[model samples]
Target: MGKKSKKGQSRGGNSQKKTGQKAGSGGNKKKSTAAAAAKAAKAAVAKNTPPPSPEKAPVVPEAVKEEAQNGAVAEPVPAVEPAEDSKPTADDSGLSEGVEASLVLFTESQQTLIKNLCSPPSNQAHLFDHWRKPSGVVSPSSEATNNVKRKFVAQLESMDASYPDGGLVGYISNAKTLLANSKSGVNPLEGWKPSVPTGQMFDKIDEEFEKVEKVGLNEVTSCGFVLVAGGLGERLGYGDIKIGLPTEMATETSYIQFYIETILAYQSKGDKKLPLCIMTSGDTNDRTVKLLKENNYFGMDEDQITIVQQGSGVPALEDNDAHIALDPHDRYKILSKPHGHGDIHALLYSKGVAKKWLGDGIKWMIFFQDTNGLAFHTLPLALGVSVKFDLAMNSIAVPRKAKQAIGGITRLENEKGEQRTINVEYNQLDPLLRSSGFPNGDVNDEKTGFSPFPGNINQLLFKLEPYSAALEKTKGIMPEFVNPKYKDAEKTVFKKPTRLECMMQDFPTVLEGEEAKKVGFTSIASDLCFSPVKNATKDGVALQKNGTHPGVAASGEADQYAAVRKIMQSIGCDITDAKPATYSGITIVPGPEIVLKPSFVSCPADYKVKFPNPSSIKISARSSLVINGSGVVIESLDLDGALVIDCEEGASGVISDLVVKNDGWKKVRDGSRDNEIIRMRGYHLD
Candidate 1:
């Protein structure tokens, strides 16, 4: 991709005042660079009518009226009904002048860089030069629109492996299609060109990554890292702070701790202790702060770690039947809603983090959630992968045979019929996806399916400069979402949390091979990246309570057991004499029949055992059961004293009556439940 003008410098201002405006008042006076993006989205929906032929429309829509009130437009908008007071205020005039002034800061070289940033990659190369030469002007007549679309298709049809000019001409064709279809009531082709205009500053960053030195600990020393830890533990019953829940074999270890260690380790390798930032939600920020401070930043430098408060914008729920917004307070009294992690891009852009990091010499920005600790490897390894592939990489996991969870990579064709990347969940998986070599198996067991899912871990690595460049180049390319938007008005009338997934993948595609190189993406093996502390069962809880973990196990224990049993028979051990051996707390038990190898016994260990690994012994309870040092004992008295356990856990299990005597509660906490054989907060007792 060619370079563009250097219009990528950061602009600082009050975000709220600049992003919205009142009806007929035009857009906000103080516009951020992101505001001038194409309105093709809304235009795409209004493709039927011919576009207004003027450079700017005389009559704006009711939507624009509302948009004006919110100050959402990037260009200076004239008042619909000019009033004496409607004249541009000094601040308004200054903002308009300021934007144009700022654009001028970019040199010719910079504008070229910006254009490259917006160009698509070679593999899926097809350009839309709406920012430069739009199609509506070339073909104001309906026949011209048809001709333009046909010509664009013809160009794609002529493509070979090595696309001509890396699909540069295809881009110009796309812009034409957009203009022909655009009904923004404004002529989209005014002053259009096959490329970005000169003297109009445009900042450009390569979408593709280039190897800096092999990333080392030294690089970590100077970088500042922050994790988005804003989600509540609602899915897990919200009994405790999700961030504080023990996720490591040692009770002291947690998801956040692992994340912290990984980043700190990278920094340490560089011999530069880096600063770590954690964005916590309002509900858990206090406890999170205390825990971090008490632990002295969990083995990292105290000053190197900082906790910041995340967003509190909860989308209002709506009643489907009444078609009215509902109060979230009606459900949970203490629900501290967040605007979702997608807010990171906007927040960072507006909050000046991008500039701050740039000044601080941070070259790349890696973002991840605090749930999965599997891909929480140090930045060196992740950065190495990113640079190696020249991609804005995302760490993914191969889907289970047919596991049905949300979210997966999607491949779609744009108007140019060029392959593009889209990330959506299983629900949104298009019909084309099923035929696209995705895994497919039994519906019940998604793991058995034929789909090969790149399970997104929400881990991303991006060249910070390139990301900023892309933002500058495609400024205001995104739509202002009405957040917390729910689908089913009855069940989920909450603010539709419109995911900014488009931007994450879209930006990379926009910069591929030109301003950027390519967007690299692949899946990491489960063993290498599989530590997720899902608070779902007794076993998971028990594993965290005990000190035994399976982090370093090379092979499955069941396989080990099978091997040992065969060896025992070869050694003439008496298999008939074998009986259940009770062991606990990191104890190694040799089979009475002299098995070749001894199996290690861990009580809570089973709780945190890695998924898909089979356990030797399994135990489960329907009503209630007691787990003690003697091993799990059934206490159902309804079996006529003949112990007969009905439930099963892990692979298979059946246990019968044993000497079970207990009043149930083992602890004396005043708030704890009593007289219950099995105690779990959210489980239903029947």
Candidate 2:
């Protein structure tokens, strides 16, 4: 919560090799001033994980792997045969002659730092001492393996001055848990009872929603927004950052722009400009920053947005000793992996952003994932639920399909026998249910025809003070687990070095008694707010044929357009289906393409006010309307083709009494062309 007074001096890289290599790689300087290095090295353990490559997910060391939202992990791998190449390449002699041979992989400066911190008589020596495998005689590991112990020592000593020594101890404890989970094959839901959690459910945008939205509108000025966008859009067929993609082609507004606009729009309705914190990984950090800088922070103040990067290079662990794993291709490189989005909490806390928001008088923090256009549409009502219920934590959820890929919001008893309503991981949900006496195991409710356990989209609302309190208790680090695939039943060697992972959605686990009671969910209609852009066009088609939901850009865009049309029809407009368009072997439902700019109309109440029952508005098949501008009002209009009305926020728009019907932007599916939007979403407009 205080200033990181030592970061500047500490971040300057303690040694020559570390000069430009960010401090996390265990680069502490002189022994006389070695404490800071110990702190910096600690960063490699908690901040994030995954290797230099393995862009998707760091392969878990266990047969079973844990996956985070926005990404998938491979299925259980078979017991691997020890490949000749993967074995450690020892030096000519399999014994350490001196510090030079043992610490060959380290820079001279790093070697010295390790010695000063873990040499005999130093209390921290145990950290290095544990890296050894002592037989009858103190036999040194193979020269190559000696370097691993040297790495272990340097990693432990490289913590920052700001990180308490206690924090380093905490990470070690987590590493032990990772070892236990790897051996036991972690069932995170062990000893827990799973059942539906109680919360408010909004079936539609009715009077109740409008009433709650009013409360949310007032609360907007006091809230902070956190966006989890640590991954790219490769799965969605976009080669760049997913958040940079457009929500819909109507105005072709980039997701980032819309998010900023939505925040500002709500701010304008309330009092002050709220802060936005985006969590990024090594993959998306530079581009995300460049995007904000290039677009002038999307019309918001530069300081209003804070971009924090997750430490992607987490050192992988190989066994129960909490030994740092070596890379298959290169032993010098400690196999780093992504720590999952759960790193956001620790990043926010370690970087002091969460505390800063608290200082700014922000009472609430609303968290959402990137590339979901409908999330903000229902955010106001959801925020209202948080305020009205005085909730400590509110997860915005949707009715889930049986055995869906998504995690379910369930009330469960943890290992401590404490009850917390949280998102139970999808993999663990069914098994836990079946083990707990539910025959069908995570099936749909008979009456509702949907899973009783609400679907989690990773969108959440937190009452700031309590959330911060919880973060501080854990030093902002989530309880992380390591997944290591083993080569045999003995669990002696790894199939592949694995990484540590935690879920940001696992926050409720950090809470105690009554604070846990305050954790709940706000279930909203899926059609209104649950469209996620996740898969690529080909993958979508493949998934569809296999009876899976094709959560690709095409479907996301279609859902957005459908949401806009449904909202219009509910108000007063006569909206009907357009001719069906098929792309990538999947048939997009018949519907007019409509893009509603939040500036024009955000909530159901706003749309109802602009167009009453007698307003007389009808949008025909193939009509595409793009509307923007806060002052835009349509009292009467009829369109059969593309209609674009764009203006400054307070300027005139496509006003009332208009009848325009002409050939609009043509929908073209030319595969050879270079239209990014069409190519990514499987349809183009020329």
Candidate 3:
């Protein structure tokens, strides 16, 4: 049995040898079959997929490359360790190390953008440090947060970098520092005294009126009126432009219309066209431009007007110094706020408006706010004062009434022994010092007998050359003040955060030695020129009721409107005192819809000669009329409502004959009524 098993094993061994030789010989055939299968699969894939362009080739990761070389299947790659400085190297993201680091807080899409667009490096990361943990609470990392960070960083890096050597970055940094260290809470009455323009000085001003008038007229051609119309009418509960708010006039004229008409009237008195510069914030710029264009620039040449967009700032975070997010849900959009009036100088310089003014031979500039109806009324006189004194800057002030909550004009002797004119804000004054009979606290100049410092109306006349020089000298840096304001006025009961703002009138504080000496102050009647329309209900309604008295209705639109009417009536523009329309025992005098023609009166002295006996004309409270030009005859005309008469300069006509009687009303009437409401326009009697 052993011999048989050995033989069988030997036979099996011989069979195995023979099988191996056959397998070796046929190995090429098996390999060919495998190759054919692989080739077919490859061809199928090639037919279905398009070849990638060199520019759009896919980037294979390093891990995959190592796996391919080692003949092993690629495994999921582990996250690469960030560089020691937490910067991304070119090998990591194909972006500069700094840019990668700046984008660390950004999302994958943002990282891809940094990789592709090659954006410049910025200190945005540092700026965003405050936003990282708002209210000292770390928010979960999200796309929304990343997007917000990206936008804020972009804005910071993209600001106008054209400011001489300091650039926008330096300006922002310096401004932030100054605001952080500002003396806002200090008492201003420590070294304060009253200073005012005297009656003698006014007499002197009047004495030089003719010469000043001539000089002012000549200078008007070289002067640009800068209207700081940057504020939104939100505080007034108005969505439309504040300057476009209607004033009580026969034609329902707007403040802008009145302003333009006044400017045009002054322009008509001379051959030189006065240039008007409007400084508008982002919120108001477009609306202002549209309003002017729609009205054909109010008959003034478009070239005579220059509209400049002022810079805006973002609201700071409540808990941190970073900017506030526009949307809390997304936290991506940073909300922007209007920079204070102090931005005027920087805006003028940065926006090329100053350069344009200089090129146009504009030697002087008057910057005033738009809320005041009489803002530009005495600009000629103010310009005259500036020209007469050869002053670098002339500030127009009005006497501060007892307990008036307005800043007062003050003169301070600085450390350098230079007397600098400064505005003592009401908040900065001690309550005891602000009280009447406070010794040496009020601005009382004994020499001029002009006691108590006059309140500033923000009417400034700047000698363009020196003003430009001063702005350049300081790199257009202005002191910033922290103003507490609500983030959402409707929802939030508490103040959202403090806003940083600069006051344009604070220019004198930045000046030194000789520059301070160039600053001067002049006084004007507050009732005539300083009435500001601040609040909607308070201003519009109160002014309509109370007139221009100092204690009128907390200083609002109504007071300003009342002041304008009184000023007009004081002149010979006959505003007939018809009984105010009454409904439910409430006397309703027309608020903003009243309009008076500019040709009728430009000032208290320039009354239209056509209306020689203005008091002889009668008007009803329900009537809206425009009396243009001379030779108009009125014969007991009863105007119930809505009438316009365009009297030609030489054409003589009677109001009764000019009336276009409504035949339908006449036929329907009982004929017993002698008076009826009439709606007529451009009618002439034969």
Candidate 4:
């Protein structure tokens, strides 16, 4: 169970004194004034002087004491330790007997810190009033516990200062309670319903797309984009930044370049520059920033892009023991880990970016993960939906195939008996319930059927005002999940406390029950709009052996590359043979030698004018056709292996049976190879 606060208790203010004065008789005006003046003077003094050392107790002003005696406030009292013969009671400070026993393991220094932090006389006690006692047993000797406690105390102190509202501490404590409860072997998905977005509303997506495009053009200035790119390309077998990896495009552009191009294309439709915010983690921040600088911000104004780094959190001990050594050199120190994408909300608020967005008349923010390529074109449509429906939170979901192994968006009654929408991760659902068709079960609503449970793809459009207001109301308290991970590559032991994480998608739950109506989920075409590059290679055998679904065999990079090629082809680009062509048992490679400029076929509408009679041209995928100038010609040619056709202004070529394996062919002024061909396979170029 979570911690509970006393009814009518107020925080961070003099509400207690105000309540007491209101209850007092009207005759003590002079005394009340004196007390108020004294309190003000003490506050002023405390502001000027440095904070008292943690080694000593804080000093209370005599004025405060007088006010307490006069019923204006309650006197501070230290928590009493139960007698040796007495049994622990539930009403005792949130700490349980087991947790108290575990604290005995901490060193004296750690004990002092914990005591000061939780004691009634301490200023921080109120911040931790909601902490529930640990339910699990934790036994450690004084020395061992002391070492662990020291590190924990230091981490807590730092977090307290960093997040004064107690979000970090509250989240950690809540995570501990959740982990303990989950160990009972009960299904976490009990009573929960899983459903996806229904696409029955909009008749034509193209019409909706056009409507959204118009709205986006009108509100481009008042909108912003946030890209969550905090992760490295380690999972994709790339040691450096993932966004910088080259894609299989005609120009061999990187992921970041494609994203930038898309953004530029969208901006070109309007006059105002849209702000692009990139949320990066510590590992990827520097490299990402450097790459952007080197590329000249990808043709976008540097001022329009803002990069913010998310904060990190301390990793918990595997045994929940305070004395365990996190490292060989330092028994008390623990490793730090990223606090999950959920921290984006707090980080944006803390950095004042959220406030700035609100002030800038930015009504909506389009947030998408960095690993996606389709996200570039999907933003305007998402924003349009938010505008059309006047929604506070709108998420874009894609259809989930059977056993897709992704989280699904569902509507269910929360603990308060109010209907709400949530993202139910794959692992959170019970296998029996999942296999039985879940929300589509007989228990589903008679009026609303569940044939589609659209999977969440992390593409969201949030109304700035309501979203920010909701965040403030929740005080950034996000649901934390414990992700058990190995402490080392050997996987011998799991890290303690597990990894506490939160998700930004869960922010919709923070809104009041009534506001739930303003939140919605919209379905999108997965092929056209959802392609996440999570892994480098598709290990079908490994995935099947582990009982997990092996999604598309094609890599994310390959999928994106293919999508781009398909779009270009649809635009009537005479590049049907742009793909690698096999000849004589050898596969020829493309790119660097064969390139397609974005200006040639910017969109499908430009196809007819760019390439008239597209069937007349034969451009092999592996062949290199460099059209630096115009008037390029395409004729019958038996092309095989790598072939280079450089056409200048007013140049044309007519070749036949061109077999240039391990060789190169340069088009001369007369539209013919200088000497039939220049074979340089395995030979140096001069």
Query: How many steric overlaps does candidate 4 have?
Result: 14
The Cα error of candidate 4 at residue 105, in Å, is: 22
What range of 10 consecutive residues in model 1 has the weakest lDDT sum?
A: 196-205
Q: Which ten residues in a row have the lowest lDDT in candidate 2?
A: 14-23
lDDT of each: 0.36, 0.69, 0.52, 0.51
Residue-by-residue lDDT tens digits, candidate 4, 542-648: 55347643222123333454444444454333444444422211123222133333323223233344455544444445444322223343333333333434444
lDDT for each residue of candidate 2 in 302-351, tens digit (9 for 90 to 100): 88989888764555666666655555543334455666888788888888
lDDT of 3 at 478: 75
How many clashes does each candidate structure show, in the order listed? 80, 27, 20, 14
Per-residue lDDT value at 677 in model 3: 10
Sorted by TM-score (best first), the order is: 2, 3, 4, 1
Candidate 4 residues lying further than 4 Å off, grouped into runs, are 1-172, 185-221, 320-325, 414-417, 427-451, 483-497, 538-554, 568-686
| C-alpha RMSD of candidate 2 | 14.8
Q: After superposition, how far is residue 500 of candidate 4 from its true place, in Å?
A: 1.6
Per-residue error for 181 in candidate 3, Å, reads 3.4
Candidate 2 residue 272 C-alpha distance from true site, Å: 0.4
Clashes of 2: 27
Winner by lDDT:
2
After superposition, which runs of candidate 3 have C-alpha atoms over 4 Å from their true positions? 1-149, 158-176, 179-221, 315-329, 429-440, 443-451, 483-496, 512-515, 538-595, 608-625, 628-686
